[model samples]
Target chain A: MTTVHTAASAVSAVSAASAAEEKVDTCASEAAHPPPVARGGYTISEVVSHTGLSAHTLRWYERIGLMPNVSRSHTGQRRYSEADLGWLSLVGKLRLTGMPVADMVRYAELVREGEHTFAERQHLLTRHRENVRQHIAELQDTLAVLDFKIEHYADARRASERV
Target chain B: MTTVHTAASAVSAVSAASAAEEKVDTCASEAAHPPPVARGGYTISEVVSHTGLSAHTLRWYERIGLMPNVSRSHTGQRRYSEADLGWLSLVGKLRLTGMPVADMVRYAELVREGEHTFAERQHLLTRHRENVRQHIAELQDTLAVLDFKIEHYADARRASERV
Candidate 1:
C-alpha cells in the first residue's frame, strides 16, 4: 500500500532539477513530459509496490550494475524517475523470460556503455527471443499431451460406466 | 549414454511376459509390438538418458508413488517399459510448464486412482494448460519489449555514426 500524498511530499522535499525530456530511449519508452511528481519521482517503497520487486532486489539491481543511474533525494533516499520505471518495466519482462541475471546485467552495462554495444546487445536479445520461442513451443507440445490424456481418461470413464 | 546391445541383453535376462498391446491408453500410446527387448525394457541408466532425469530423481518418483507400475529385473534393478517411458515423457513435459511437483504428484495419484477420477484429472490438466498459456502470453509480451529496445539501439547507433 502506498500513500500518494506523503510520497509526493517526500519527493517535493528533494530539491532536484527536472530531468530533461528527450526522445532518446535509454531502456524503454518513458511517459512523454511526465508530471513534476513523475519526474521528481517515487520512493523505494513506492517503487517496490509499483514494480512488485522487493526493496532488497531493487538495491541489489543497483549494486550489480543492472540498473541505470538512479537519482537521490536531498536526504539521500533513492528517487526513481519515470524513465527508471520504464527501464524497470523492461527488466521485469526480461525476468519472465528466465534470462540469466548476469546476461541482463551485461545488457544493462552495454546500455550504460553507450551505442557502440548496439550490435552485441541486439545479438544477445535475439538469442533470448529464440530461447523464449523454443520454451513456448515446448509448453504447447505438452498441452497436446495433456489433451490426449484427458480425452483417453474421459473415454475410459464412460467405458467403465457401461460395465 | 545408452548401449543398445548390452541394455537389450540385460532386459531379456529378466523373465517378464510381453506387456499386453491393447489400444487402452493408460498413460500414452505404446509401441504396438515392441521387440523382445522393448517389451522386456530398458535399464535405469538407459531411462536416465532417455528422460533426462537423474537416477536419484527416477528412484524418488517411485518412492513418492508418482510412477506407474515399474517392473523389476531378477537382481531387483528397475526395468522401465515403453509405457513407463511414455508416462515419464509426459511427466517431463509437465515439469516444463513450471507446475509444482506436488501438483504433478496429485495428477499421478488421479491417474493411479483409475477412471473415477477422470473428470477431476481433466479439470486439473485444463487449469495447468491455462497457466501455461498465460505464461506463454507473458513471454510473448516481453518479446515485444526486447524488439523495442533492440530497434531503438539500432537507430541510436545509426544516428551516432552520422554525427
Candidate 2:
C-alpha cells in the first residue's frame, strides 16, 4: 500500500521551488537575466527552453493578453525580457492549479495596471489559493482510495501464494 | 498573511471523503443503493445525480471502455446497478487526479479481467499514486508563492494607509 515518491518526482519538486522563486510580481527589480543578449532580450526559442512552454504557447499567451506588450526585436521578432520570464513562470504555476485562462487573463490585466490592483490581486489569488488547496485535498483522497485497492490486491496475492 | 480555509471548501472536503467511501472495487458486496429502483437498476439520470457526471460523460465513459459492460434495460435505457455507482465513484476520483483517459480505459479492462490481474492493477495504481503525490507537492509550492505575494500586498496596503 505504500508508494515511494521517487527521486525523479523529487527533482520536479526541486524545480517547482525554483519556479516559485522566479515569480516576478513582488519584486520586478530582482528579475534574473542571462548574460546580456544581442539586443538585451531573450529570443522565443530561449524562452521556450527556459520556461518549457512551447513557442506556440508563448505566442498565444501574448496574443491572448496573458503576456502584455512583449518587446519586439529590431526586426520585429518577439524578445522576452527577464520580467517576462518571471511572469511566465508564475503563469505556469497557476496553469498547473487549473485556474481558467479567462481568470489568468484578468490577473494579467491587473498586473499591467500596476500598484492600484494589488488588493484585488490579493483577493483573486486568495480565492484561487483556496481552490488549489481543495484540489490537493481531493488528490490526497484519491491516493487513499488507491492505497486501499492496492492493499486489497496485496492481500489477495498473499492468499493466492498460500493456495 | 493568514487565510481561512472557509466552510464552503470544508463542505467539499466532507463530500470527497464520502465519495471515497463509495469506491466499489474493494467490497462489491457492500455496494450501497438508494431504496431498490425498478428492476433493481438506476436510471441514467439517477446515476448522473448520484455521481455528478453528465449523462453524456457517463455514456462516453462506456464508449471509451472506462465503464465496461453497463447493463441496459428492456427499452434500451442504461441500467446502472449499485456496483456500477460504486465503480463510477472510483472512476470520478481518478478522473480528478487527471489520470489519462487511455490509461483509465486500460485500467477498466484490467478490472474486467478480475482476480488474475490483481498484481498488474497494483502496479498500475502504485505508479498513478506516485504521480498524484507529485502533483499535490507542486500545488503546495504554488500556495507558498501565493502567500508571499499576498503578504506583499498586505504590506503595500498598510503603507498606503499612512499617506
Candidate 3:
C-alpha cells in the first residue's frame, strides 16, 4: 500500500512538471508575438520606402536636425527604431498639414527636449490642425471653381454642337 | 406726312442713341467697380497683404525665378499685375502639393514660353498629383498607426483599472 501511494505521488509530480513546461513554451511563443509596442526596429531604407519620402529628403530632414539623432550601423547606414518611425509618422502629418519645414524644425526641437513642452507641442498641433482645416476650406472653394470651369467648357461644347 | 415722319424718325433715333448710352453707362459703372483689374498693378507690400504670403518669400520666389518678372514702379519697387496673382495662385497650389521650388521654377520657365509646353505642363502636374496621392496614402497608414497607439494607451488604462 505504501509503495502504491509513493508511485501515485511521483506520477503527479511528473505531470505537474510537464504542465509547467507547456506553460513555458506558450510564454515563449507569446514573447515572439508582442503587441504593437514591441516592434523591434526598422532601417532607414525601410522607413523611406514605407513613408514614400525620397532618400534625399530624408537626409535633408536629418541634416536640418528635424529628426532626432538616429543610430547607425557599423557600415554607417542610419538605423531607425520603432520609436523613430512613430515620431517621423507625426512629422509626416505636420508636413501634410502645411507646417513649413522651418516651423517643423522648431517643433522637432521642442520634441527632443522632452515632456516639459507637452503643452507647447499640443498648442502647435492644435494650431496646425486649424490651419489645415482652413486649407481644406480653401481647397473646397478652388474645387468649386474647377467644377465651374469644367461645366463651362461642357456647356460651350454643347452650344457649339447646337450651332 | 413726310415732315412728320422725319421728325418722328429723328426722335426715334435720339431715343435709340440714349438707350445705347445708358447701356454704355452700365458697362462703365461695372468696369469702374473693380477699376478694370487694377492696371496700375500692386506693389510687393500690396501683394503680401492681399495674398497673405510673406514679402520675403515673394521676393525669394521671384529671385529664384519661379515667378515671372513683374513690371517695376518708378521707384523700383516691384509692381505685380492681376495676371501675376493668378499665376501665383497656381504656384501656391503646386507648392502646397509638395512640388519643390526648383521644379516649380522649371515649370514656370515652361509656362513663360507659352502654349507649346502644354503637354509638359500637364505631365508635371499629373506627376505631382500622383505624388500627392501617394503622400495621402502614406498619411492614412500613419494615421492608422497613431490610432493604434492611442488605443493601446487607452487599453493600458483599462488594464490598470482592472488590476
Candidate 4:
C-alpha cells in the first residue's frame, strides 16, 4: 500500500512539472514578439536597437546605478543575455511609468534576494500601482484642461481671422 | 469717437480687474483660516510643519539647488513669505507628477524671464504633458500585469490552503 501511494505521488509530481513547463512555454510566446532577445548574447548597440532606447541613456541609467551590472564580453564590451533583456524590459516599463530611480533601486534589491522577498516585492508594486492610478486620474484632469485651452485658442484664431 | 471707444475699453478692463480681485479675496480667506504661518515671516520650522516635509529633506532639496534662495530674517533664520509658500505648492505638484528637478529648473528659467518666454513655456508644458500621457499609458499596462500577478498568487494561496 505504501509503495502504491508513493507511485501515485510520483505521478502527481510529474504532471505538475509538465503543467508548469507548459505554462512557461505559453508565457514565453505570449510575453513579446521577436522571441524575447533571441538566443545568445547581444552587443550594447544591438540591445539599444532592440530595446528602442538610446545607447547614451542606457549608459547613463547604468552609471546612475539604476541597472544591474551587465555581463561583459571578453573584449570588455557589454553583452546582454536573454534574462538581462527580460529584466530590462520590466525596468523600462517601470521607468516609463515615472518610477523614481531610488524606488527602483529598492525594488531591485528585493528582486536580488530571490523568491524569499516576493511579499515585499508585491507590496512595493501595489503601492506604485496606487501612485500610478492617482497620476492617471490627475492626467485625465489636465487633459480636460488642455482640451479646453486648445478650443479656446482655436476660437480666438477664428475670431481674429474674421476681423 | 475715439474717446468713447477708449472709455468702453477702460470700463471692460475695470470689470475684469474687479472680477480678478474678487477671486483673490476668496483665496485670501482660505489662505488665512487657521493660517499656516504668521503674516510677516515664517521660520524653517513653520515651513516644515505646514508643508509636511522634513527639515532635512527641505535643506537637502535647497542644497541640491532645487529650491530658490529663501529669504533670511534679521536673526539669520529662513523667512518664508506667502509667495514662497505659493511657489512651493506649485513645485510640490510638479514633483508629484514626476517632473525631474533639472527639468523644473529649466521651466523656472523660462518663468524668470517673464512673458517674453510665454511661447517657450507653453512648449515646455506641452511636451511635459505628452511625457505624462505616455507615462500614464505605461502604468496602465503595468497595472494589468499586477492584476494578473495578484490573481495568480491569490489562487495559489487558496489552492495551497485547500491542500
Best by DockQ: 2
Question: RMSD of model 3, in Å?
Answer: 22.0
Model 1, B1-163: lDDT tens digits are: 0011122222222212222332343443366754435445778987766555678978999898888579988888898876786677666677666676788889999888876788899888888877777667777776776776678777887888898
What range of 10 consecutive residues in model 2 chain B has the weakest lDDT sum? B1-10
Please tell me what DockQ candidate 2 reaches: 0.42
lDDT of 3 by residue, B1-163 (tens): 0011112222223223323332222133444454323435677876776556678978898899987688887778787776677677666655544467777898899879875565566566555555555544534443443454345445655666698
Interface RMSD of 2: 7.5
Task: Give the RMSD in angstroms, all C-alphas superposed, for model 1.
Answer: 10.3
User: In candidate 1, residue B20 scores what lDDT?
Assistant: 31
Candidate 2: docking tier: acceptable
lDDT of 1 at B107: 90
lDDT of 2 by residue, B1-163 (tens): 0111223333344355455654334323444643434354778887666655668988999998998878887789888876776677776677677777787888999989888999999999998988888778878988988898889888998999899
At residue B162, candidate 2 shows an lDDT of: 90
The C-alpha RMSD in Å for every predicted model, in order, reads: 10.3, 7.2, 22.0, 16.4
Per-residue lDDT over B37-142 for candidate 4, one digit per residue giving the tens place of the 0 to 100 score: 4334667787676665557856776676666667777667777666666556555545544566777777777767765565666666666667657556656876
Can you write out model 3's per-residue Cα lDDT over A1-163, one digit (the tens) per residue?
1111112222232222222221122122235656322333456666666666667877889999998687777678777655565556566555554467787898889868875665566566556555555445434433443454445545655666698
lDDT of model 1, residue B152: 77
Q: Relative to the unseen true structure, what is the C-alpha lDDT of residue A82 in candidate 2, on a scale of 0 to 100?
A: 62
Worst 10 residues of 3 chain A by lDDT: A1-10
Flag clash pairs in model 1: none
Q: What is the TM-score of each candidate against the true structure?
A: 0.72, 0.79, 0.50, 0.56
Q: What is the lDDT of residue A25 in candidate 2?
A: 43
B-chain TM-score, every candidate?
Answer: 0.72, 0.77, 0.69, 0.68
